[model samples]
Target chain A: MADSDELFSGLYQAVLSGDEDGAARLATRALDSGHSALETIERALIPGIREAGDLWEEGEYFLPELVTAAQAMKAAMAVLQPVLGAEAKSLSLGRVVIATVEGDIHDIGKSLVATMLSANGFEVIDEGAGVPVSRLIERAREVDADLVCASALLTTTMPRQRELVNAVRSAGLRAKVMVGGAPVTRGWAEQIGADGHADNALSAVNVARTLVGHRAAG
Target chain B: MEGLRPKLEMFTGEEADRVIDHALGVLSKVGFLVENGDAKALLREAGIEEKGARFHPPEAAVRQALGTVPARVCLFDRDGALAADLGGDRVHFDPGSAAIHILDPGTKRRRPPVTRDLCHLAWVTQACKNIAAQSTALVPSDVPESFGDRFRLHVALLNSKKPIVTGTFGTDAFDVMKRMLVAVRGSEKALTERPLAVFDCCPTAPLTWSELTCQALVDCARSAIPAELVSMPMGGATAPVTLREMVVQHCAESLSGVLIHQLACPGAPLIWGGSPAAFDMRHGTTPMGAIETMMVDLGNAQVGKRLGLPTHAYMGMSDAKVLDWQNGMESGIGAILAALSGINMISGPGMLDFETTQSLEKLVLDDQVCGMALRLSRGISLDSAGEAVELIRELTVLGNFLGHRHTRASFRREQFLPSRLVDRATHDDWEASGGADARDRAEGEVRGILARGNPAPPADDLGRDLDELIRAEARRLGIEALPEV
Candidate 1:
């Protein structure tokens, strides 16, 4: 077996290289070559990228550099995701379909949530930017997705994010509707009848996991 | 029925007078507290007397002290060319207004804008005629990282052409921007004498300061980077509940910045830019484009204009995402009202998503809207029965003036023509043309701009040195293995 140290070193190099494509290639190769996906992630990928975030916070790395390194590490993880199942469980902790909902063309928030979810080992089907209600539901059903995470930031678009939950309900796939964004709040979540809500990307980790748990028990 | 002549402000003469009058009231009765005893004396000698912690400045003296600050200043590029007339006519899209995401080309993900993207944005803005100045978009995250060279790269990449409005890293951000200006201009003295950058040093409102804000102000004043003192108070939350109370808090905070500007270097221009939003009690969010917010918006500028302070207010943004009916209604109304109220500078255009996201399409769309708002403030001309006269005459003759020479001459110049933003096309045409909504088209446009336009980068040698400098700065800050710039 190759030394874990060498593997970690390559991962770190791949991250700093801002070569998302290269990092994904190496992650897949590492998985195929008998190294555990979780190990590579815990030992290298997450740590390497997180190091960049820490550095950025410390003023060592600025925004462009930190963002690029995160992209590289996240890209690498994208490849290993399919191979990340445990012996007793499914390939994903949760099946999530996330999108920036209708009338909300700004997907920066949705994009961040997707990346963080991808990092935390959630099987995320990211419907590209500006997804309408029908498409979000159709995709969720197609994937048999456990969670549909909708993001909206505008006062006008806030209704659309709420509408996703209703559309999913009408389609009879409303069992696990999740909604969030700057305009979204705990009160709004209850008002919209959503099963789950996360204020930010980090809390989204726990929320998605909890939703998946609800699905499994059901 | 004209009552007064045209001032530089296009707001109706009556409205402009009221705005100035309101600002005078704020300056006098609620005179801003001079933080230092010496500066307190300056306000007093100018007939601004103190009682307890609060001080009151009479209108006459406040106007004279304000006279010390240049009402109008011109931004100049490295080549010593005029960039923009700061006080009127133009609304410059200052680069970087607190964007958290840098969309990664490879991953299609959103992450913090790094040094490279910050510099890349700077280079892009430097080359962009639409963008008059550069701002350090929320680098690596919030304003907390001002101490890092993130702010330095922001100024350096802007070195090519764009006159800068950059913040320094930490309290030393002002010093760093000056040094960067020197690097580009080839003289420290030149930068100090004719500052290229305007430091947007924001004071934490409701009277508080982190070490960084306090220090940045002092250095920014000392360095002579024309500083716009921005005080943002989220009313009912950050400051007092009422709009008037909020404006009072806003004035006090901005006045602190003015005091620093005078104390550090007298005669240095300091603007009264207060971005106070009325907080929505139910949600704990500031509805930035709400009517109450705009009321505070008008009042904030009212106070500034009255004090003869170069007025700046947070205006021209919507809480909506797309170019939907709501986006148009909210932003159009808010922006026009703010402009007609006679605000000199307005920010938060192209802002969206409860004021978090920045849409390039919204930016372009708002620019067109700003054009409309500015023209609207000019009001109607009564001199010899203006625009309506010729059009009405045409109606009596040809039934349509569209084919007339008068129509042909005025159409393009009179109206703010939008390209690809406003869907004037019929449903059939819109659908036939890929059915791309404004958002899709905007996304396509953003991609096209990024792909086709290459902003001139810093010289290769400077680029290398920049990387080394960032690495060294990181090492000192204890972040290892920073990716390439």
Candidate 2:
């Protein structure tokens, strides 16, 4: 039998080099070697990609490089989807359906959160740009999503953030919600009844995780 | 019907003229203080005499030099369409200036930015259609050399087919930029009449310019390039605590710029431009999102419009690091206001971190907003906005307007339909389509733009000359020429 440890290291290196095929191949080999899929992903891929994050912060890397590495890691994760089905539950980060609210249609900030969450082990259900409050709530329920990340860039459209929160309540899901964008602040987040707030993408992940934990504890 | 154009009298008038005249008197007599050595050297080359602490550009010499400036210019595009008309009512957008650092990979911290960064930034700007003109993100010093002049010319080569808005460091670069402009418009006279570039000459916050800016006023004027007298006054920081006082300082500095510039080159196109804001006491940062920032943006343009001078202001920029709701609100409102106000050449897109960092996402988003704002200036036509009553009638109580002739005609061009920015579908439709949200769509959009390299060819052979001029300059400054990424 092949050594799972060595196979896992290969998965890490493939992702770091942005080789999607290599990463998926290595990920499958490790899975076949009877290595726990969750263990391989958590110990190998997560740490390796986060190191890329560190490299980015250190100025030794830029966005193109980070994005490439993230892409490869996501490719590997996608390959593991069918095989790891029920076993994936324990490793899964609560899914958050993220979108920008209607009447305002900028989405890059919201995408960053999706990336961050996906990298951090979330099964992010992205309702690509310009989601109406009604759709956002319905999608969150359909995905069994624990959180909804609503981003609105325009002041004219900021009210839609609040409308999403209200729509969630009216739907009786009251799923933990978070709001962000250029005009959004902690004050506005509270005003709109979001369960949590993230000032940026990095914070959004931690906040999303914490919100889910809080709801589960309740 | 009263047009949507902003009223100049409400913001500036005879009172502005008097205040500006007083400020000019202060400038002629007291002059300005200088601390930076290179700025000092440039001033001396431009004919200012340094007297210990001050560089006194004789008011007459300043006026004499100002006489050489040209007053009007028009930039043509690759298809010969009008791209931007400087020294006029057109409000064109450009990138941010003088970012000292970018997020570094090796250290996870910011360090001194180098020319390679500038080259990358230039390329990035080139790829972006929203960038009507350009600015250097930083000077090249990756290996430590005198690349200031070469850097300016290089950026002109890399970014603009439209007339450039740039500046120089020393007398040596004056001709280099001149050569570069010649390369763009195709003649020395074209540089003057067609107006390929506008040299930025800034006044120190509050009331004065160090000797270099004053000397630059004269030099830029004599050079026959339009000079943008940018005032960066902040309420309660480097300026008086009041917004009015900040405006006064801005007016004063601009008049002082005009006084010296007119002296050097009279009737040259001098724009009143600025990056004014209120100082946030809590954070010790200038709040570019503050109401005062908008006031300064609107107010200074008012001052220039009153003088019948071309205007520019550092507006339409969000301090937001990413394209979030706050980013949209700050940038969308600010940019829309800038267009409606009738300020010519508003320069702030792709600006972030209080004018220190640049984000690709923010830049594209800003452009989308810029598209919407520019359209705002055209005003909603009565013919097209569709008779509201008629539209209601057309929509017979139960019938949908989805495939209506009016809707079909107007949907594609009249409305600003966003890609990856907005959603316009039923809930079920949104859910079925990857169920992805705006952010997801934006992320995909950003990935797409960067992946498909958008390269515009150099406007002319002058672009090649500009490149050579800049490379020669970098070598002379002891810096390696930036390599194309």
Candidate 3:
């Protein structure tokens, strides 16, 4: 059996390269080698995803690379989750329910934000595009979500973000509502009573961390 | 080409001489406090002595410094192309700099800008036809406060091909910012040969030079970068209440900057520029859009030109919070007057709310305003009068000159056709387009320009070097990750 450093590097390289099969294989190897699932995740998978996030922010990695890395992280998580059981819950930064507001079918921005949030250690529940505000709030309540993010790409559909914020508040949910998209601005976020706003996917993770009261990574 | 150009002169030649004389007198009698030790040492080398904590330069020292200063300063784009030529009667424009907040296009309210906002601004500036250079327009709140100065310049170099008009905050900021420019320009020598930026070094009001600003001026001169002296003298507040005294004070401060820069490195490029405002006693604010402020700017530039040096002014900006009639009135009048006065570089196209906020929508709208001002400065060309008479003789009989070849050949040159931002359509046509207001139209234009993306992104190797340098600096400052551009 490989030593711990070599085994962890194998998993990290697997995730960084977006090789899902290799990630699952290395994750199992680490666990079979007497390493706890939490140690495997903390020492291997999380560092891999954070490096990918850094590369994406540095402009060296594109969207396709980032999306695939997220997939590899998910595959590794699938292999490790059962052993960790409820301890898996503590590994995530927070639970976030993300969606595009109603009447807006633009999914590229929302999907990118979801992938970024997930890679940055948030347990992202992506409800996809054109989701109604009521269903979004309902999903947040179902997951006991810490944050709910809504994206509206058009000027006409932007008011839906405001609706999501109001619904989340009126429902007496503890989830912080965050807004974004093509036409959304920090001013719009303030006007609609959102907890925070991010202009792009990379910053979305930081905003989410801040909203959930986590110490944001430097 | 030889036709007389329309011009606006705030002072006659004799009056300009009188202003310079008064400025020299002020420098000699009431010396400016030199905050930086090196700057004071340079002045001492030039036969100026510090008395009572001030450096009182004699007339000969000022003259010697003025004699070596270059009359023109040229700026190059990121790809080493000539972007703007700042010389006699040549008008170039860039947006205002260092705004803490940006006016959101969607909500029309002001908020702190981020990296993406600054990158979008660089793309917009790259696409503008009349705005020739980019400014470090917004201070991104996401970056560490110490990194803001170089980070703004880094973003501009990455996203735009135009030369940047930028500045530094602290004494230590100039070196790293210069390194970024050097990387883009291939080497320090290459950057010096074709300067990619002009650093705005501002002296505080009331004849005091802060240590940081004085150091920036020294660094800019030594690096062969153009140092734009921005002496902001507010009438009735920091300066004398009267306009003439305000103008004289502006001159004295600017001349002191010139002396310091030239004493550091003789024949270095420097621009005689200012953002002086007429203080409003009623509100205790400096109104940049006031006519009195514009006069102070023009008077200062007039002195700069009389000294045979390049000139700059902060004009064509509004004090209005939103795009409205007041915005239009102030922006238009300032642009026209600045152009007519032949200010070499105008630096306030997108500023609003007393220069604290920048609106990208207003920036696109102001591009058209600058276009019209440039057209007006061309005046009437009498080069083809005989041809015009012949066409008139032929068209008088037919009563239909629309199809005339002469009209066809001259219409494009004779007219300045504005973009969709200027509403020239019929009422029905306007309504057909959803009756969008100027703000909406401006927003659409900004979207279109940004959609086109960066026309002149840096090359891959250059881009990588820039990223590595910025990342290393950010890490040194304890910023593990910077927001993507």
TM-score of chain A of each: 0.74, 0.86, 0.94
Candidate 2: misplaced stretches above 4 Å?
A: A1-218, B1-3, B6-73, B77-81, B87-89, B103-131, B138-145, B169-171, B321-325, B384-404, B423-443, B459-464, B480-482
B1-485 per-residue lDDT for model 3 (tens digits): 54788889888999889989999999999999888988988987777978989988888889999999999999998888898899899898999877899999878899999999999999888878999999998999998878899899999999999999999976778988999999988788999899899999999987888899999999999999999999999999999988889999999999999889998999988999999999998999988899999999999999999999999999999999999999999999999999999999999888999999998999999999999998888889886776777877896664444324454445556767677789975454466678999999999989988888776788899999999888888887888888988
In model 3 chain A, the worst 10-residue window by lDDT is: A56-65
Per-model lDDT: 0.63, 0.67, 0.88
Interface RMSD (Å) of model 3?
A: 24.5
Can you give the DockQ of every candidate in the order shown?
0.01, 0.01, 0.01
Ranking by TM-score: 3, 2, 1
| Candidate 2 per-residue C-alpha lDDT over B72-96 given as tens digits, one digit per residue, 9 for 90 to 100 | 3455442334667755456677776
TM-score for chain B of all predictions: 0.76, 0.80, 0.98
As for lDDT, the candidate ahead, 1 or 2, is 2
Highest lDDT model number: 3
Model number with the top DockQ: 2
Which model, 2 or 3, shows the larger lDDT?
Answer: 3
| Model 2 chain B: ten consecutive residues of lowest lDDT | B1-10
State model 3's lDDT. 0.88
- Deviation from native of the Cα of residue A211 in model 2, angstroms: 42
Error of 2 at B124 (Å): 4.5
Per-residue CA lDDT of model 1 for A99-207, tens digit only, reads: 9887777766677677667655677898866789899888988988888999988878889877888888889884498888877777789998899887756457668
